[model samples]
Target: MTSWILGLTGGIGSGKSAAAAHFSTLGVHTVDADHAARWVVEPGRPALAEIARHFGDEVLQADGQLDRAALRARIFQDPAQRHWLEGLLHPLINQELLANLAGAESPYAILVSPLLIESGQHTMTTRVLVIDAPETVQVQRALQRDQVSEAQIQAILQAQASRDERLRHADDVLTNDRDLNWLQTEVERLHRFYLSLRGGRP
Candidate 1:
């Protein structure tokens, strides 16, 4: 049977990962775009070749892999460089995401991507689910989890679509302002709704 592909997205530190985890517990197959992007550029992937061409060999470390720290520093220093990197990786990631969704044999598949709304990939899914949190909470969580300063968190958030923008684009919104138990309950409710979308009894 064709699986129902649900696009899961959220702001930075909005607990989208936790929501995806909850879906996994219900036997839903989940494909994370960030993880897929990393995998495609792993050893022996053409994405590495493209990376070398765009950013030069310096982006690769002695072990012949992308130096994430170096690349992050470079991109943050220049908006054009960051856009170039996204242009190269986004298409490849989308291709792989679609492939994984097509190959899924489960009742549904969750495409967990932070940029689902920004990248315009939400159109490929049956529904867009946003794991939302207030900007203050998001900034706080990001600062604590990533060990970055408030200024850094602000810059990151500024680059992303606002919480209001995300809500405007969402078919469903799972607020992550509360605790894990709340997150789990919201995910369960969504899981059941996803099943109903596929004409299955929840």
Candidate 2:
């Protein structure tokens, strides 16, 4: 049977996780690309070995895991490095992500990725759902949750598709600049809409 996949995406700190959690509460099977990305870089993974070889051992922590911050800094500063890294990991991550989605038993599945559009993962879905928030809100939220400076956060945003660009690609959009209650309501509404698209009725 064919399952309708929803590509749920948003900029960093745009509350994509929170929106996905609500869908989970409503029984949606959700897969996160970030989790798949990390899985591909586990200590013994071939991808990790290649990354260490190219970027040097400094990109790995003493614990032998990927030093995400250091690696993040390296790739962002060099376009060639960023392109190389994405070329290496995107296939690995996409393979595992598609496998996971195929195994899902739910009537539909949600794939959440910050780079869903940019990484070409959006093509895997029949619908694209974008969780949007103001740039000011994104900056504030990232400052509160991560250790990065405002400048660093700005740099990350620069690397992502512009807010308008993301919206233009979306089949649906949810504004996440408000409180959880408001976000939850939008999620629930979308949840039912997706459920209606399924073969079974709820």
| Model number with the top TM-score | 2
Worst 10 residues of 2 by lDDT: 193-202
Model 2 residue 77 distance off true place after TM-score fit, in angstroms: 1.0
The local distance difference test score of model 2 is: 0.91
Which tens-of-lDDT digit does each residue in 94-192 have in candidate 1?
A: 999888888877787889988888887888787788999988899888888899788777777776777888888888888899999989998888777
- In model 1, the runs with Cα more than 4 Å from the true position are 199-202
Say which candidate scores most in lDDT.
2
**Residue-wise C-alpha lDDT for candidate 2, range 95-149, written one tens digit per residue:** 9999989987788888999999899999888888999999899999999999789
Question: Could you tell me which residue pairs clash in candidate 1?
Answer: none
Candidate 1, residue 139: lDDT: 84
Task: Give candidates' CA RMSD values in order.
Answer: 2.2, 2.1
Error of 1 at 145 (Å): 1.7
